[model samples]
Target: MLSQLMVLFGFFALVLVSIFWINKAVRMFDKLIGDGQPAWVFFEFTALTLPAVIGSMLPIAAFAAAVYVVHRLSADSELAVVQATGYSPWRLARAVVVFGLIVALMMSILAHLLIPNSLSQLRMREDEVSRNVTAQLLTAGEFLHPAPGVTFYTREITPEGELRDVFLSDRRNPGSAVTYTSSRAYLVQDPAGTRLVMVAGLAQNMQQSGQKLFTTHFEDFSHDISSLVSRDAINLNKLAFAGTPELLRDPQAVAARTGAAPGAVMAELHGRFTAALMCLVAALVGFATLLVGAFSRFGVWRQVLVAFGLLVGLKLIESAVLAPVLVTAALWPLLYLPSLGGLALAVGILWLAQRPGVWRRIANAIWPWWRRARGAGA
Candidate 1:
């Protein structure tokens, strides 16, 4: 049973991760390729995103594997034969519990190490890509809008790396607009930032309120263009990129560095643990749910639906607690409520599966009301 669970888990995890990864890759391809970036950059970005995608899909895959394995065993009468030999539901669930622990260990590694490192690397790469001005503005005879309210055009480019007949309009300022027309220009990078050094340029400033135009000519003038091309610089101090140990050791310090509230930091720290614990909960719920009621030749489709619904309910509970937890650090314990609730639910289902008389009694009590309602509707 353990071997079957492991095999199915790998298969389901691969299929799910591939589907989600392909979807994300498509959107990244459009954005990166459309921005004139090379194919290698697109591949690097997609590869960096794999850890996060795998992390999100593992719990679902584990749940599916557990459910499918149990369903197949019951369908083949293997479970029935085992039960006849006095193997209780709890005993049968031991393999499933061990499988869940293995998956939980995988989740722990991803949440604590791989995910944070990948996200940090991704952010750094994005910063580099955003600042690559040549790739963004090197084409000749075409107008470029590197940012909203900014337009740049160069009539020609010399092999010597000089821009000819450059025209630039900056309307980012609401009170006045500036237009710079230069006979020649060079892009310069310095310790400060990137700048466009325009020679023999004419600056035209137009006041929006009065529609007045003022013009000035210069031998050379430098205009800061870094903000136009790049986004805000990457801040590595973000809590999302911090290690779990760092977060737990001094959450207030982490909060200060990331400019988040202390409560938010605590919530993030606990959220990681809860995410890993959820893997165990998901696996157990899947196995225990299928163990309920008698096996049918028609299969346990209803039990599968119940298990799916239970997972959804757990997620809903998780979402519902997040806001309050974020508002108060003391409520950090609430983050584990969903996982705890799921474990309780799994235990309850397993107990019910062990007691056939209890199930019959409950069904008998509900069957009369179900029949009466059917007759009234008819």
Candidate 2:
């Protein structure tokens, strides 16, 4: 069980990492590269996001490992011998339960600690990159787009960081466009932000509807830097940027991070804890679901499918209740519904596994209905 769990975890990690990296690479590369940023910036931005990705993947990895190992053991009759040796269904599931708890603990650490820090770092890095004028602009002879619909180009950049023959276009406003051409310009850093100090510049404004042009020439001009990049909210607006304590403390304030209600952050806090619990829940779902029936040499693939189906159903339930829970803290109990359901299901399955007579009674009650349904389908 240990060996299989380790192997499956590594396997799942590689598969998930590759999928996430490939999906993120194109966008990250273009976002940095289109802005004419360097390769290292591309790598750094994508790398920082990986912890959140890995954190989300851990539960599924644990689930898959448990299912695969249990199904394999049943197919090999290893589980039957273990059961014959007086290990009850739940007792035989001890290794899997231990593995599940270990994974759950790891997930708790990540959800409560590491993922938020990584997300915070990613947010800060993105903000810094956007604010960086040297990286985004100041490249001589190349057109630079500091923001959407905004472009700047300089014919030459001196070693002293002076811009010569600058062309700047600002079209961030959908109704009108502004363009600037200067003989000389240099960026000035202030507490507010970076500003362009242009000498001997010509400004042209054109309205989008009328295409009316207005031109002005000045010996000196200072343009505010704020419009050159996207402005983020004063506070981090991502739930992933806050830990459980941050989320629980002043729930309303943290909920503002997601523009949600007072209970939103509380739901998030409870969700993180419940999400960790779900790792164990998912593992037990796999273990218990597979243990119910007699062994099949062909494998317990049918039971595995049933377990997966149950998990999917529980996830759907979780999704359906999340919105209400976020709005009403009284509904916070819904956050644990899936985990509790899984636990109940595991307990129920173990009971059935222990009592073959009861299982026989259940099969007798429903087996004919199943056949009828199958016949109707056929």
Candidate 3:
């Protein structure tokens, strides 16, 4: 039993890592390339994204592994042999349940520790890349668009790294367009962030309706470059970024400190635990769904599809609950409804799987719909 559980778990974990890592690497390549980042940066960013991917993959992997293991056992006649040796279906499922618990614990650790840290690191790395790319745009002899609707050009770079001739266009502001031309300017990094300091510059402000261009000559002017950088949409006060203990502490206090919605924070706290606990339910559901049907020489592809469909339906229900609970924390308990419902459904399915009469009844009831689906496909 231990050997079967480990083999299935290891197989699923490997597949999970490969598929998700490749997917993330592809996406990260496009993003970093668009930002003019190096190849190493692309690899680094993709690598940092893996922990979060693995965390999300855990429950699904557990379910798939459980389904596959059960299918394999039934096919090999080992499960039948065990049953003939006086082991009940439920008794045979103990190792699978243990496997589910192991996965759940691993996912809990990720939800509480690794995922948040990795996500935070991704945020920091993205900011760093943005800052570097934005700063590099100040090179002489070429026009650069640091961000959409923001253009900058410098004619020359002094030994002291000052801009000899600077031209900037700001179209980010609605209802007006602004341009700055300076004989001398410099980039400054301060607590506020990167700023372009224009010395003896001409400011041109054009009104949209009238096309009236206003010119103002000034000795000193500054434009903020921080807005041009893409950043994580995460609110610092967001419950997603908080540690487990911090989240469990004073909800109101944490919300006050972060200037976030207390209800949202509280909802996030409970959601993490539910995320972990759902692994067991997912595994049970998959196993029970497959076990319901008679052993097939053709294999359990139909049963696999049914299990996958059930999983998707459960996730849809879970997503439906999040909307209301996130806004109204009083409904926070609704967050666990999908998992609880799945658990109860799994138990009923397991009981039916053990009883041929009940299983036959279910199969008989489902036959029409199954025939309809086959007919439609044909």
Candidate 4:
């Protein structure tokens, strides 16, 4: 049973990860390739995103695997045969518990180590790509809008790496517009910023208020083009990229480094721990839910639906508490409530499975009302 659970878990995990990863990759492909980025860059970005996709899907995969395995066993009467040999639901659930622990450990590794590192690297790469002005502006004979309200074009490029017949229109300021046309231009990088040194250029200025135009000819002029490229300041000290130990040992320091509230830091730290625990909860809940009733020839589709609904409820509870927990560090314990509730629910279902009379009594109480309602409707 344990082997079957592991095998199915792996299969389901692969399918779910591939589905999510491909969807995300497609979006990234369109954005990056549209920005003149190479295919390799797109693939690198998608690879870095894989860990997060897997982390998010792991619990769902674990739940599906458990449910499918249990349903198959029940359908084959293997569970009934085992029960006839005096095995209790709790005894049979030992394999599932072990499988859940294994999955939990996997989640812990991803949450604490792999995910943080990948996110950090991805951020760094994105910053580097955004700051690459040469890639954004080096193409000749085609107009480029490096930033909004700015148009740049170069007629030709010499083998000596000089831009010829360069034209630039800057309409970023509503009150004034500036246009620069140069016979020859060179791109220069300095400690201050990127500069386009245009030789024998004409600068044309127009004022919106006066509707007047002023033109000036210069022997050489330098235009700051650094702002033309999008270079958003990368926050290297993001809380999501920090190590768990660093977050735990000195939350105040981490908070300062990440520019986040103490409550947010605490929420992130505890959220990782609870994410792992959720895997265990999901697996156990899926297994225990189907074990509630005796084997039926019709299969356990009703129980499977109940298990899915319960999982969704747990997720909703998780989402509902996250905001409050983030608002108040003291409410960090609320992060565990969903997991605890799921465990209690699983235990309750197992207990009911052990006593057939309880389900029968509950069904008997509902059947009479159901029949009366049916007769009244008829």
Candidate 5:
């Protein structure tokens, strides 16, 4: 129960930090696209973004938090007392790993299934907003930019789709601009249900060629623009798609990308295993490293420094390796290699710290070699 509570709190802290990080990115994107809404609306948007963030960061956060908690317990000599009472570190680590497994599986579900569906829904909502909105509600000027490239101006517009004094400038590129002016224009839908048609009573246009410009006029014209989206399910790209089950179902694709066998899907299939295993690895490393510096007594700040360095270094290497493995070899080295390495390092360090005779011999082997060189120089 205590371990579970710690994990829950750790997850909460990790989520808060992730959300704060995302808030910065969200504000920047909002400014870029001018999608700012009221405070309540922004809060809602952030809430929508949370599941995605949790899906991505939960495992790492769980690992880090587990490591920290274990280290703290060890530092306070709590582990020694527990062990005196016949509770082994490995046993505790098993519990941590179990917790990690649960979180990992939940994350996979969110990442693979929930997030994708939510994103598609959000897109559909935005599309509906853009499509059904009236030109007057969207723009109120002789010239208005509803979207980036299209410029529209109207002298008169009626609720019944009658548009008079319509002027449009399409600046899709440089050195060529198409200008259209119609005495009257209206929107019409095709019975085929394939397209929306814009019918015009009279139309005029000016086409530009370098420094030269040519103009033309017509009595009737029509225009059509494909809808923003058609009826199709969106695919979560390789990076964002989560869940080992789905990845396993399509083994050929994953194997082709990573050069690994279908069993490699276990990484995604058992994300919690990976995360909990990572926590155990980190706990072993953190405990041993802290003990090594115990006499020096560097304290929490020092532990924080070492932890930050180790975590950051591991992350950099993992990200660098993950791309190639997933892209070409189908080997997920990033997911497992660091975990293994951490575990090995932790075990080695713990053994060395516990066995003083072994440490002395190892120290002597290096010191004598250094002294021989100094003696010769003197």
Candidate 6:
């Protein structure tokens, strides 16, 4: 439990750091868009998106954390006593499963519950903000700049559609300076569509020395303003939102919407299960590698690299090859073959870790593939 807690806290910190780095880059683009909001606004907006980030991060965090904890104990010579006492490698691996279960529960909550609800709320709040009235969008005392060439200042705005004093300057025009002020003004939307309709109690307009100024007050003035939203609509039925249960029950529906065959959902659903099961697989792989070779003495780094390589290879294959098969083989579980392969590999590794001479047989089969991987990486 303590290990689990440590890993969980470390994962959260990792996610926070990643989000901060992403925000640093996003803020630069947001500044160019001139949203009349501060950097903190973008920060808050980005921070609320952590639920989406949590799901993808969980598996990698679990794998890295498991490797880190296991290796650190070994490096400090803690595992030597356990091994000398006849604590089998399998028993040692069982301890890691305990931690894996904790991570799995956290992943399930983030993937199936928290993320979907948060995404729904985020979309709703975004819509509300975009539809907000012009008065709500404007600020008092400070010059509000929403675009490169537009500046707005309002002294006060009341809930009852009254503005105390207002000033607007449009600096986009080269030769002339257009300044407008009014004692009291109110804003309305275009009755026809999405446009701003401004109506004033009194008005004054000045232009650069083109014979005096024009004053108008009797009724209304109107202008067009763009809506303030950045992202596309967030629909919850995407593969990520379906969760494991939903995906299992309605593979057809998922296929239709996602344009993948039934195998895609089957693949993804099985993939998630397989991913959770990696705790067992990694433990097997790590233990097997460590036990067989006294001379080869492949340490923690080798164990980590082996696990990481296998995990990444499985993921890349699922994305690049199996993902496409989903569209062609909707009814059949073709995508699940990879998951089956992982399970098979795990079982084989466990068997070899127990039996004599199995490593030589497996090594002969696996060596060529290892060489290929090394070559590709180079």
Candidate 5 residues 171-190, lDDT tens each? 76655776777776665556
Q: Candidate 1 residues 109-210, lDDT tens each?
A: 998899999999999998888788756777688898888899889999899989999999999998999999999999998987789999999999999998
Which segments of model 1 are wrong by more than 4 Å? 138-142, 147-149, 153-167, 170-233
- Can you write out model 2's per-residue Cα lDDT over 280-347, one digit (the tens) per residue? 98888887888877766778888889999988888898888898886788789888988998889888
Judged by TM-score relative to the true structure, which candidate is superior, 4 or 5?
A: 4
* TM-score of candidate 1 to 2 decimals: 0.84
State each model's CA lDDT, in order.
Answer: 0.92, 0.83, 0.82, 0.92, 0.55, 0.59
Of the candidates numbered 1 and 6, which has the greater lDDT value? 1
When summed lDDT is taken over every stretch of 10 residues in candidate 4, the lowest stretch is: 130-139
Preferred candidate (TM-score higher): 1 or 3: 1
User: Which candidate number maximizes TM-score?
Assistant: 4
Better of 2 and 6 by lDDT: 2
User: Highest lDDT: which candidate?
Assistant: 4
Regions more than 4 Å wrong, model 6:
1-34, 37-44, 135-292, 295-299, 329-332, 353-378
Error in Å for residue 26 of model 2: 2.7
Q: Using alpha carbons, what is the TM-score of model 3?
A: 0.73
Clashes of 5: 6
| Candidate numbers, best TM-score first, in rank order | 4, 1, 2, 3, 6, 5
Query: Model 6 — which ten-residue stretch has the worst lDDT?
Result: 288-297
Score candidate 2 by TM-score against the native. Answer: 0.80
lDDT of 3 by residue, 59-108 (tens): 88888788888888878887677777987668867877887788889989
TM-score of each: 0.84, 0.80, 0.73, 0.86, 0.59, 0.62
